[model samples]
Target: MVAGDGQGKNIDDLPDEIILNVFSFFSFNELIDTAQNVCVRWKRLAHDPVLWRDKEYIIRGRAQNGRSCCGVTCSECAHCRCEKTDREVLRTAGSMPQLRTLTMMRGTRARILRKICRNCPNLTTLQLHGCQKMNYSLLKYIFEKCPKIEKLIIANNLLADRRYAELVSRLEHLQSLEVFENRRGAGPVLLRFLADACPKLREINLSWDYHPLEDVEYFVKAKRDTLTSATVRWTMAGKRCVVTVLKEAASSLEKLQLHLFDVAPEEEAATFADLGELHNLRELHCNQLCPHRPRLISLAFQPGRLPLLQRLHLPHATGLPDDAVATICRGCPALRELRLIFATSLTDGALAEIHRLKHLQILDLSGCSGLGGCAMAHVAQLPALRTLLLQYIDDLTELQPSLRHVLDLEQLRCLNILNSGHIRAVPFEEFAVRLVNLRELHVTYEEEDEVFYKNVFAEMQSQMPRLRIINTFRWTEDDFLTDYETDDDGDDGDDDIGY
Candidate 1:
């Protein structure tokens, strides 16, 4: 039943299913701290096991005595906060018998962790972040307690022992694993152990300071048939291994990330060619290798090569050619999100082809200085366009026409024009009034004076009170002095701009 029906009923009159559905949106802390005290009905529903199952309980922040904060904001209390937190976790874990995912961040105490894991018998996914105290014994204890764990994300921990590999290999049910900054001397041994032991492993993300070519290739080749997603980072010395990973995982790979830096010229040219053959690839992300290189993207991005490609991110892609962008736009018609930040070589011709992506929703062309007003005008024509980030484009000086075209997109919710200093305040304010559906506006000017922008901003606030306007422009002390020195009677051209 509707809460505000003509019978004069309230939310308490609603069915348990509807109330539980609303309660599902509340965080674990909110449910325990606030919802449980609301009413007798809500108190019972708050303790329901379904509410806690499969939820990601993130334990972060500083606690007294260097223990995990457990979402509490107490520094000094009569009772020991650490023991209180441990009791709370143990009690919460009893309510979450079906809990599947548990995430623990920095400052988590050993006893508290053991208490939660021992109670959460069905826990399958464990993510440990910045837990410096997580040694080999603590991890092994966790593995033993939570034997059903299938996915593990251990980041920025202190597990530098090769003996940790022996414990990891014992998890026969493990399917996905992500290790970052913990595999210093044990990376090679861990990969070798995982290849032979972890039969169900389908996705793996390994990131550290350095990657040995021999170890990476052997692991990739061995698990190529089962692995569907891989995130591998390497330097100039491991170029051949990068190619081997792509070549081996081409058939089954659906998601791939290559964080290649300090790459040799010849190896860089040969490595990118293998990417075009991955027909099953749905998402591809590559980091910048060299800014001075003539072309970072390969010419192999032709039609029908990557037909299933949906998302492509090439951040800091310096010297990226316009034809490559054109080819990606034409070939990857199923593309939904595209981010080519700092790709300076792109022009209007490349952006013109981008409108062909009928399903495109998010487009971030930040720092592409080569694009001008015409390129932006074409980008605003995408029907499904919701987020448009055109930051750091100095050549987009003609704001009035571009803003007029942009305001026509009824679905456009976010527009980012940060660091584009040439935009006039009056025209921007005028066009912003028409973009009624716009939820976010990110704009900044490099001009010294702030008087003109201040007036425009005030007017915008009065006109579009619901719109979120983020301005990164900073005014200097000289601009304030200049404003005070100038006569109020003097013509500042505000009249000519029709403001």
Candidate 2:
């Protein structure tokens, strides 16, 4: 393409920096398969290490893509689809010697990881997810190869023993560490290692259970000045660690998530009360709340308290009243996202207060059974609102009033109304007409009405060609019995249908 100047200069006439900047937008796959073959200059620019510094190469498996099993490697195996992809990834990783981050997903072979590790010496972040039985030797090999790694995440993977901690402690440059799962072997020993050895650690997310309160408190206290994000699961016996986190890391802590097992009513109340002073908090999620609910109300209800909070997730606010919601909305002026999932006791009145949140963009009121169609009027008033989730909400009938309110949301991009039975053909058609800005829509239908709604969805898709619609069918009790009905030969017809 020629530049629109009098000289009619071609793209190659531009400086190498400008051409490389343009090349940066292309995906690694595009760079390898297309750009590299485009021209000599383009290929050379495409191979620049600066482009791959933060590009995370994801290596996922067939199970992740909804398959039973990825192909097995036979003795005389021609490379399977997965094997081909792995070979491509290793080749790409080898080219990018300055690669900073690599994410290997489920079913990643250890040999492939070891190869990538040895190639990318400047690697700073390594994330391995859902690849179970990750022994210490593999981790040790990775650490030895990528000595400059700063952020490490091993989520949903089963670890062998304490050697996981032993390997992690060697990363002197480590800043962020996340090893989250219920079935991990690491306990308080991991926390002890992090507190003692890893001085530069600023973020820690360990979802392992049975971490004693004393060890938890000591770790946070030790790194109070540097720790910016902390997610820890501790026993209920030492709930005072909540206070320690709030008090010690009050100035520096930006994100805080605490998971406590077997928490009593009074202990929950105390924990909520202690959260009043964390002024620097940007995100907060503590599942359990006091029965009184007023303790949390005070923290969020007061002016200038938790002023910088952008996201507040309270999933267990089962019986939260209207006054509490009103107070939260009134106080947290800068809140961009608020999730009050399963707050069953809330009514449409709470949303009226939420309309005051001028900067709010994402709101999730899923499982708020008490909310009806009328609440959407207030929800639609949020100017910056883009994503709204109202899954399993009761009485969201497809009436003119509700449909009109939802259509008023001109900026809405994503809407999820999963299992919301009352919203049928009329509301969706109305949405297809007015909600043109919508990019993604998730809806569910009962088994009996599936075919009818599928047709309705087809028409909607034609009207809004840019929209992505995800359809789900909620099976009825009768459908289950029909599937198991015996035939004349005493054979169940279930074998013919795939679940």
> In model 2, what lDDT does residue 312 have?
89
Poorly placed runs, candidate 1 (over 4 Å): 1-16, 36-44, 47-49, 53-55, 63-101, 122-124, 155-160, 183-189, 212-214, 234-238, 291-293, 393-404, 419-426, 430-434, 444-466, 470-499
TM-score of each: 0.76, 0.76
What would the per-residue lDDT of candidate 1 be over residues 1-499, giving only the tens digit for each residue? Answer: 3455577788877799987898888765667668878888888887676776635554444232322224222223211122224345666655555567775544345566767787777788887754334555566778998998899876523323356676788898999988777433433334677777878888888645455676667777888888898887744134444654557878889998777555567665555566677888999887773433545454446788788988899888776788878888888989999999998777777777888899999999888877755765788779899898878766466433454577767688888888866766225665455677777888885567578777877788777877888887454442221110112222333221100
- For the record, the alpha-carbon RMSD of candidate 1 to the native fold, in angstroms, is 13.9
TM-score, cand. 1 = 0.76
Candidate 2 per-residue lDDT, tens place, 287-364, comes to 654355443455544667778989988786776878888878887899999999898888888877788899998999
Candidate 2 positional error at 352, Å: 3.4
Regions more than 4 Å wrong, model 2: 1-15, 34-44, 66-93, 107-111, 129-138, 155-166, 182-186, 234-241, 288-301, 398-403, 425-436, 445-499
